[model samples]
Target chain A: MFLALDVGGANIKASVFKADDAFALRSAKLHYPLWIRGVDGLPKAIEQAVALLGCDLKGASGVALTMTAELSDVFRDKKEGVDKVLRKAEEALGSFKVVTNDGSLLDPDEAVDRYMDVAAANWWCVGWLASLFERDCLVVDVGSTTTTITPVVEGKVAAKGLNDVEKMALGEIVYVGALRTPISSVASIVPVNGLWCRTSSEYFANVGDVNLVLGLLREEEYDVATPDGRGKSVEECHERLSRVVCGDRNMLRPLQTRLVARFVYEKVVEKVCEGVLQVLSRLASEGRYPEVGFAAGLGDFIALDAVERAGLRGVLLRDLLGRDNSIALTSASLALYLAYKTGVDVGRWISSLR
Target chain B: MFLALDVGGANIKASVFKADDAFALRSAKLHYPLWIRGVDGLPKAIEQAVALLGCDLKGASGVALTMTAELSDVFRDKKEGVDKVLRKAEEALGSFKVVTNDGSLLDPDEAVDRYMDVAAANWWCVGWLASLFERDCLVVDVGSTTTTITPVVEGKVAAKGLNDVEKMALGEIVYVGALRTPISSVASIVPVNGLWCRTSSEYFANVGDVNLVLGLLREEEYDVATPDGRGKSVEECHERLSRVVCGDRNMLRPLQTRLVARFVYEKVVEKVCEGVLQVLSRLASEGRYPEVGFAAGLGDFIALDAVERAGLRGVLLRDLLGRDNSIALTSASLALYLAYKTGVDVGRWISSLR
Candidate 1:
């Protein structure tokens, strides 16, 4: 089984699978956050990731790391920066013959160009969409902190060579998310009785927080950003958001805060939906629409909201999660899978570049 | 003669006077960013705002709006929801008839509660350190996306907030800054050593990108989000990066593309000496810990940076900035003038908030 990990700025998810003809999945996905690493939490977080890996990863022949780490900071020379990544990954992976953007699987030759070709967005899973259709496709993978709209003609991510930091202000990489995004960033002042008063933009307010308040994010099914700033937990979220807008706790109340929060959530989602629609419209103008494919690690709300709102159709990410109930790999997972199936050594493909 | 407008998520600024004195300065400061009208480069963008005001604020006011606009996003809530800011400010300011958090004119409102009881983090500036210090006090307004470690303790304007959609990630009073920032959410990144790698959970990066990359941004700077499928600029970013990384420019580079694109700008600045050190650090930390004072605007980087690196000083911001730039002010020019005269708000009261 080839183990693929779709590591994004906000999420680190894994799926174990055997992908020769049919895919068999193993393991429940774990979604942790990149929020409070605070210079001291890195080791523990990595340890958690390792433990999670230990739970499902067994008898895996190879491992590929699809990450948003590349989106973290800029390098003087992007290519040279890629080399630094390989070294860090090498250190982190310990014995894993980790892949690189270079053609060589493991060696770090002085090939700056050869090593800077790995593609990752906030929703890194979208990388897998490259395998879905051979024709042109416009991939819109929206995740926490940002949404990336990549134009792929015949299977490739199209955009500037920007990491997550630089991409935050750009449009294709909208800096909003379903579960973890803060609310104040979405709207400076939401219309309240048309008076145009100021609002408190605290981390307490987010798309998910409002969505959850509005019944959009169900506690029973959705994966939420941890209230305590770790991997999400169902019980914890329910407890955290049980307050009503009227300041009542546990019991719900129909008031401004609740209504406002919910409406804002819907509007934020709508804004993104509109953004995707705009992107798709532009793609149509250029003939880059693939037989649409839908996939995301999120529950039905975001994807459904987006698809219904955007009115695009394709396979659901859950179904094509590639052969397993295994931590359904995101699109990036699918992209990596296809890369492997095509006799392309993704590690070599990445490392051998240039 | 240059009109510097700091349009923050919280306050709308128009400076007619150039740091001379209160009335003599001729700067008429009013509150703005009360509530965000729209994000489609409409109502809030420069031209729209001019029309919305129903007046030609041009030559009369040196028409400028300093904004934390770059701190905006589709998915994230502004650090301060554009709601409840003014009301809270009114309430906070109303309680304090006190003339200064600065030790100058002790208005009836200058009681400890008036100066110390902050309503929200946004009006950190209203505390008025400028009215408290006898000399030029440096202001280090460190909030979410960026940190304006300005040397406001003194008399010169020293920094600006312009890069990485700096205003958006800083605070929401502008409903545009950071609420609970994730390390990955700070700026974009690039892989190093030929692999896709995240920044160290430890001390890997800094705040220059969020506020210092593109110089100080004014209301006039507005770039359209790249057209989704037809966005040539995004494509160009892709091509440039792909060529560097050995990936095909015509196709999506998958996982690395967005991350790469996002990191491009921030990475470029990383190489510049200023990118790493906004100002000399040791020079700041070892000085006589001043009661930091910030200017009342989004572009107050110089003063804030000076205080942040100063280490020994108490931080402050203006009420104008949504958050960060913690020195709050009832009036920008007047507050500073009062602060310069008497240094009353300058207290020996130190805490371990840092």
Candidate 2:
């Protein structure tokens, strides 16, 4: 049995898994504004998350970790952020392993020397796990503020870009996602009253509001705060979406607001589809194409819809991992990959836990 | 003998023009960080600008006003911004006629009653002025933070959309300019080290840095503060542009930084060109195409380049208004339009000035 943790800017996710076969036994996710709370709260948050998962860390064989928290604004720079996160992880889980951008696992000491490799490298573990299922496949993980599109080939992670910056350049990482993305960043012009109205760049609304208004996201899944600090009611969502075009709910009818939401949804899907095509085209140029796509993250539906729109085959991570385990897919994958790569006796550890 | 003021979010421009034939006499533009200084600085800034033009506002026959300052964040909302600007203009220039979105002039009281018409309506004055020269033309004004592309037909402003939001919806306005526009807002991917890299979404640099590095803008014309609060030297511009890809001067060579700047410049030009094409396509569908493009604002060179790239006849605003007067072209246009529309005896006013 191994504990895996995925720490992000906005939330922290943890999972306990039978690492040998990548079977997640339990998982928990907690929202923690690391940027506001600072790195000091990370350890407590991790403890609470692990407690919710009912995991006995001392009895675990080892811990695996991947983080995007280093990119959060809490730290002055990414290097400082990485170092601080590594120190906190050490305090919480001694002698743990870190998943890196190069699809390798490193111990804490080596992680510090190769800090860039481990910084915001959670997607790499997901890509590696996806490759294990199919030799030729794409891993599409749409998180709160970004989307990662990684191509796998011959049961190996095949990516031209190593880091977020490089991946963004390669069109493999889109700076748009399900919940926290500002709607102004998605589509500057939206359809309003049968005309395309330019969205106010004031960040009065975000993608969460769009999805909420469109009924694509459940009320409970609306985990983030609204841009206007309003409730997550459909009426409030409409009001927020209306403000994207500098209109209030009173000025725009509910139907008009719904149209605005639809436009934003379509634009985001189009963006993801464009990224998918770009990655596939790059692979095709190398005489390879992803035969299937694995969709993960909170915005998995978006990825599934984009895949179908792009005329590609796709499978939801929940369908593959089971619904209860899907929420911690990235963390589970990190643990499983670390065990496989490091030759950890995860099966024996699972039996001991029983 | 008439003074015109065009106040925007970033700068305040003023000009003195002859009422007859709309000939410009003198003009001045003063960079004022209205968003930072707040509306409280407006009176002093306007006085300084008028003083720089060596004009006597008290002796003027009348003052014409148009403003985008209402959209600045200094005010709680557009209404308050407009009302405050009107009050300031009344205090500074006595009884002034304000330009409205309908291309007509109104007194201060009527302007308040129709505040929406007066809010950010400076573009209307430019479009009206452009229509005077060529009935079928496109006025492409690239300001510091936004671009306005207004279509004229048969010597009339034939805009499908009114106001900034409406024009933006019509593709007559693009939220990109030659300066002060964030570089990340231009393109997510930029060329780096002979490969594409995703630029850091942080506001580490802006279009001003891009143009500064490329020599398109003179050092003095880099009027706004940089994203990193650095100077506007070529070396500093390189450093700022490098930060767009999350690098500094130490990490990237000067040549590499230049490539980044060039990429951003191309992307901005492409955006403006796309807006121009969209507007032209709409006109073409209506059996009318702009025969020429009138380029104005601080980014006239960019507009000229885009117009040529779009295969449209281009004329520089400086050519029409003269080099010295072009700095305040919008203000001069407002003054001329007010005189033309109100039938003000500008020849008498010029004689009085003499």
Give TM per candidate.
0.41, 0.51
Query: Model 2, range B289-340, lDDT digits (tens) per residue?
Result: 5669888878888888777655579999777676545556779777776666
Question: In angstroms, how far off is B274's CA in candidate 1?
Answer: 45
Evaluated with DockQ, which candidate comes out highest? 2
lDDT of 2 at B16: 83
A-chain TM-score in candidate 2?
Answer: 0.92
DockQ for each candidate? 0.01, 0.02
**Chain B TM-score against the true chain B, candidate 1:** 0.31
Which stretch of 10 consecutive residues in model 2 chain A shows the poorest summed lDDT?
A: A345-354
Give the top-scoring candidate (TM-score): 2
Where model 1 places Cα greater than 4 Å from the true spot, the runs are: A20-22, A26-35, A38-47, A50-58, A70-88, A95-116, A119-136, A154-170, A191-197, A220-252, A285-295, A322-354, B1-354
What is residue A98's positional error in candidate 2, in angstroms?
A: 49
- The alpha-carbon deviation from the true structure for residue B118 of candidate 1, after best TM-score superposition, in angstroms, is 50
Candidate 1 — what's its lDDT? 0.38
Error of 2 at A168 (Å): 16
Clashing pairs in 2: A169-B198, B135-B155
True contacts kept of 1: 0.00
Query: For model 1, what is the alpha-carbon lDDT of residue B232?
Result: 28
